[model samples]
Target: MSPAQPSAELLEAAQRPFPDAKAMPPSVYTSTAFLAREIETIFSKEWMCVGRSSSLAQPGDYLTYELAGQPVMVLRDQAGALRAFSNVCLHRMSTLIEGTGNKRAIVCPYHAWTYGLDGRLRGAPFMTATTGFCKDDYVLPSIRCEEWLGWIYITLDRERPSVSTTLAPVADMVSDYGMENYVECFRETHVWDTNWKVLAENFMESYHLPVCHADTVGGHSKLSEMECPPGLAAFNYHWITKEASLPIGNAHPSNTRLEGRWRKTTALLALYPSHLITLTPGYFWYLSLHPKGTGQVAMIFGGGLSPEFMADPRADEYVATLKTLLDDVNVEDRGCTEKVFRGLNAATARAGHLSYLERPIYDFMHYLADRTTGFDRSFALAAE
Candidate 1:
């Protein structure tokens, strides 16, 4: 199908009952025009998870991201408050900073315009002589930013629901985990050769684990043990209980909060548009994804130890073990999703039936249909 072809058939199929649902059309995964529509209607309007609040522990710590093609920066100001602003320099429009790091002020590499951590312009060399050019006239445009359960989120849409409100059910579901107390140990970014949704759907379900992740996490996952439930409005989630492959995946001896199954169970959450999380009793890891056209995805991948594990004497070894396991799992996911994207390009390709295990993907299709096609279907629970 051409990139601009409408996905009416796929949208129609999404409304069917779970037992009859099918995978979304291949065109939806390979369409640049569809991706552009999603950027405007969904990504631009929703709260996007950037990283853990714990990642920015000090004043001057900052990170940059591109949201719906807009450059944005999130940082800790001198007053110890978290703030998000347009990363573009007000003077020449050059991006104020790159990647992640700490600095006393944001300096424009293009010309030397400098802004304080509060995003107030402080210096601009040789521009003072220009007509009415006052540094006081400029301040970086602020973006809506908030922290909930220790995760930092930013949105371009000022009127969107607050993260806390939208994700309250999720917070309640994992309440005993005390997510806010988790400490980030590392974060990294990577670009993958697959459609963003392909990767997201992969994360949302475990049916593929025994096959795709056989070398890493597969041996630890049993499909029959996975719980695929109906999703809520802002997200879709499922659960699984198994002996953790990593010792840290289970509760620490010090943790008294989680009872029986929860100590061994993991919650896999797919937060709409694109944040995916795997929360275990002793650790958490996530992927915050942004699309690069229809065929590639830019991902911020990070994870950390839960408070109980962080306080353990073996914290350093646990961190290393978690990182290594996550790295291996990511490699398997990259290969699997890339192949799916390639298959999507074939002339004979068509979507087939969705397994009960892929219920999250079914909900995700309804979400896309709602935004892109003006479909009136509602995924919200009466109360969550």
Candidate 2:
């Protein structure tokens, strides 16, 4: 079947100049048609962040991810190479795995069909009873998978650019942060009761820090401290300079090259489609968002210390305190984003003017418009 396309009106809206922009129309988030189109045009084709490569530590270690309702898994084969496969058994299309763990071989829970970690079909009990049955032709279908800086990203589309090529701008800007060697020390996954785009937009801006995060990190947010740069090929970023608030804020010493408040500065980066990251000198945290439907989003939230911090004897203490602070902040942000989703659905909800402080939010909206409409309209903020 041919892939679906978004509505012409949506494409027209994307080309509107920034000064004329209001928040996107409600239908973009609440409509069934739009969701289906997005699944076809965006989710299936994008190089999406699933989790960290470190999550699979050994051969046969595996983790599952879903894109547009199709389940797929990432694993290390006997060759120690990372690979991705459809999580459904070829026999009856039953989901093959529920979660992450080490497996000697992948055995389907239902019909006992088995597959090698490399995705080749190994055996299928009783299948020989059927004429013309060929186990050799029944390998689990593979998805495109790649690892960049400890993160594992996968895509259903075979023709797109590699993840590194697509996101090289983000890599260039944060190259000083040493992400390649940074291991994930803490991770949490949850399904939030909000539209996926809402949480993604929430992550790209600090405009609400004072009101939404009043008691947590708000005090550190000064409008002057943020520098919102224009969007580039694969991503957009704004820099925030604030002293460390979590106990582990400085638990690890800063790189000698980054002196002064640059050590405390955090680069808030959003890779197009939906990967958001906070790159700080000492530690990093991220949110990878995916739509569960029009009304819910699955969030993979995680953090880890820089190598310097990980090497510190006091790393454990700092991590404990940092987690607590983030936990509180997350509670605050959840409340705020869920409210926004509810507001978007209301009769009173309407697009609003963009604030310079919310520049990253502006960039993100442009990105969504471009993807949905098949045009690149990412340029120029409304006059300052």
Candidate 3:
């Protein structure tokens, strides 16, 4: 069935209650069964962020990464179009690319078989003419790929919902913010020793800002002053702060750049299933989470803003400023999330429910639970 027709029962299930946010259950973060189910039902069918258009800026440029235990490659073809394919070779199931680089063609080191940028089998050095081998049947399998604001996303399930449908609300929001012209300045990755959900939960709420980020983000804006909007996916928290409020001496050295700007506000937007976009002055950054296992997650961060902003002479002066802000924020979060993950695994605490103040996070959990349980039912019932 179509994405627009998600079952009413599933929607209701998503809107149901869990425990409080502070007292979340251990199973949600540590259960192997839950993780496996998430991999199959959520990650496999979702539009997962893989890389950026800038990563494959030129034809023949390629980057390889894994999602849900499946090796995937993002590359630009000879025609300058972006494409994605399973990194596994059709011949013996060996991975095609070990890492990121530019290549004229993809050649499997296992047997020297080569494939073109378009995923068409190009050469088989060992095959004999009498083998009657046909290249048409041996092309590398392709995955569904789509791009928005220079970010690349891929899906393994061919029958899954379209990217446009899954991300319609997000597209509208970013467009309203004029993000299409945003240019990227930096991209970084952090691997945390925690369930992916832990990171997502932390992002969904601003309750910890005054305590955890007091030295960095706290100096710029007051947590109590931020505006929290209603609706789970429709609105996220936003805060505007003046640069003069930044603490130059006592604050984390990483965010020292905020000292110069007249004013800047960091607008945090959390899209369901692991997509986060943050808008700061002259730049925008995003983090996409990929679960490695029940206890680990890989966070890939990318930045973009109007290209014009990067070209401005004044923008150069703010380089150190932006670096410090992101560094402190990420480092602090990494430490806290790792600790939270350990706490969830401690076996003494029970699963927590969402508080009224954390309605957005509750909404996200509801959405996840609904999708996980209702998808199969909806599909089956529709078939009948």
3-94, model 2: which lDDT tens digit per residue? 23335545555555655655666667777788877888789899999888888889999988898778999999999999999999988999
- Tell me each candidate's RMSD, in Å, in order: 2.0, 2.9, 7.0
The residue pairs found clashing in candidate 2 are none
Error of 1 at 98 (Å): 0.2
Clashes of each: 0, 0, 22
Off by over 4 Å in 1: 1-4, 379-384
Cα lDDT of candidate 1 equals 0.90
Report, for every candidate in turn, its global Cα lDDT versus the true structure: 0.90, 0.80, 0.68
Q: Per-residue lDDT for 1-384 in model 1, tens only?
A: 443465676566766777878899887887777888889898999999999988898999999999999999999999999999999999868988999999999999999999999999999999867998888999999999999999999999999989999999999999998888988899999999999999999999899999999999999899999999988878999999989878898999889999999999999999898999999999999999999988999999999999888988999999999999999999999999999999999989988999999999988888888888876555432222
The candidates, ranked best first by TM-score, are: 1, 2, 3
What is the lDDT ranking, best to worst?
Answer: 1, 2, 3
Winning candidate number (lDDT): 1
- As a TM-score, model 3 comes out at 0.82
